[model samples]
Target: MSSNRKTLWQIFRAPLLLGLLSLTGLIGALVGDGLFDLISWATLGSALAVIAWYWAKPTV
Candidate 1:
């Protein structure tokens, strides 16, 4: 693969994985009688922060 493709993958990997994991956790929280509300909110907030950081400092 081209270096550009590799770079793109690297750039997106973390956020994508985090997002997926967060979604899974949110779903789990919704189904179970745990602290789903807090967990989901916190996870969403952190994910938004990550996205903002990436948007502010995007690498070529």
Candidate 2:
């Protein structure tokens, strides 16, 4: 496999994306709308995907 280098932001993208999505979901939840529920579920699923990606990554 080729050596791929990741910058600091790239390495930290998942939690950052999760945080932004969660914040958006929270704000939507506060507004009380069906759209927010979808956003929340999407955020949750994205979180799970991120977790799975890291869990299944190859170890050096």
Top candidate on TM-score is: 2
lDDT of each: 0.75, 0.79
Off by over 4 Å in 1: 1-12, 32-34, 58-60
Clashing pairs in 1: none
Residue-level lDDT of model 1, residues 1-60, one tens digit each, is 255546678888987988886886678667766577667777767777877987999586
Q: TM per model?
A: 0.49, 0.58
Residue 6 in candidate 1, Cα distance off native in Å = 2.3
Best by the lDDT measure: 2
